[model samples]
Target: MIEIEGLSMDRDGVRVLDDVSLQIPDRSLTMLIGPNGAGKSTLLGLIARLLRPSAGHVRVDGLDVFRAASDAVARKLAILRQENHILPQLTVEELVGFGRYPHSRGRLAAEDRRQIADALHRANIAALAGRRLFELSGGQRQRAFLAMVLAQDTPYLLLDEPLNNLDPRQAISMMQVLRRAVTDLGKSIVMVVHDVNCASFYGDRIVAMNAGRLVAMGSPKDIVVPSTLRMIYGVDMSVHEVGGARIVQPFS
Candidate 1:
């Protein structure tokens, strides 16, 4: 389990993240949903130790994320932020190989090779392994980056808006891949997504935040209702049950 105790952040004298706390369970996909500037990504950064909070602590499986060794945290968790500025000339395989650095220390062993292969296969991008990133489509590049995160072979994975620039079909495919990762590989995944329908469909739990504060946290059925959607997004949306999953319909 991951425990976030009294986490807060300030940027240029403005509070970007208020005093917030949350507990993420193991082996489940939790979707963090909120409007732009709600501090969803900020919270993810804090948990991954990419950014230090003003005051509070993040503990993952009893390891103090802030004070632990960098390699130790890298071994325990992997994070993929939305924006990646890798050299476009790098081959997908080479990009994925970087994930093993913490364990391999720049020299990949047999286990590292196996992990990279497994990640490529699981991401359904084995065919693109040797292809340079510039030759791929937006969706393919996203998958390549995801493969890198998977290759890290961490128990916990955090992704920020992995579907950012993809088309609808691509987004669905990405969600399917994430579902498989959770069920087939038993990874605890926390993703920041804006599409509430996708969240309702794919998330085992939905955690809603607004203005840097947690507004609600529960199963899809509990958090995807009209009332909660209104409170979180300030838009009155109608929610229905379709195919045993809650679906939200936005009003114009």
Candidate 2:
């Protein structure tokens, strides 16, 4: 479980996240949703130790995330930010192998190779393993990066806007891959997503944030309701049940 207490952040003397506390249960896929500037990414950054909070603390399974040893934390959690700027000369296999750095420390063993292969297969990118990062399309690149994260084999995965550059089919496939990670591997995942329908369909829990504070957290059915949608997005939306999953339709 990830426990966040009194979490807050300030940028240039302006508050971004208030005193927010949350408990992310283990072995669950939680979706973080909110409007732009809602601090969803900031919160994930704090949890992943990419950014230090101005106040409060984040603990992953009882270890203080900010104070833990870098390698130890890396073993426990793996994060994939939205923007990745690495040398494009690296092949897909090489990029995925980087995830094993925590264990191999630049020297990959047989286990690392096996994990990398498994990650590529799970991400549906095995065929692109020899391709250079620059050669793939946006969706394919996203899958390659995701394969890297999966290769890390951490218990917790934090993804920020992972669907940023994917088409509809690619987006759905990505979500299904994540769902399998949670259900089959028992991984804890917290992802920031803008699409409510995807969250409703794949997420076990939905966490709503607004103006840098958590407004609500519940199952998809509870969070996708009309009132909750209006409160979070400031827009009226209609919710419908389709094939046992909640779907939200926004009206202009």
Relative to the unseen true structure, what is the C-alpha lDDT of residue 59 in candidate 1, on a scale of 0 to 100?
94
- Tens digit per residue, CA lDDT, model 1, 159-213: 9998877778767777887888789988899999998998999999999999989
Q: Please list the residue runs of candidate 1 whose C-alpha ends up more than 4 Å from where it truly belongs after superposition.
A: none
Candidates in order, TM-scores: namely 0.95, 0.97
lDDT of 1 at 226: 90
Per-residue lDDT tens digits for candidate 2, residues 45-114, read 9999999999999999898999999999999999999789988999999999999999899999999999
Q: Count the backbone clashes (under 3 Å) in each candidate.
A: 0, 0
RMSD vs true structure, all candidates: 1.4, 1.1
* Ten contiguous residues with the weakest lDDT in model 2: 168-177
| Candidate-wise lDDT, in order | 0.91, 0.93
Worst 10 residues of 1 by lDDT: 165-174
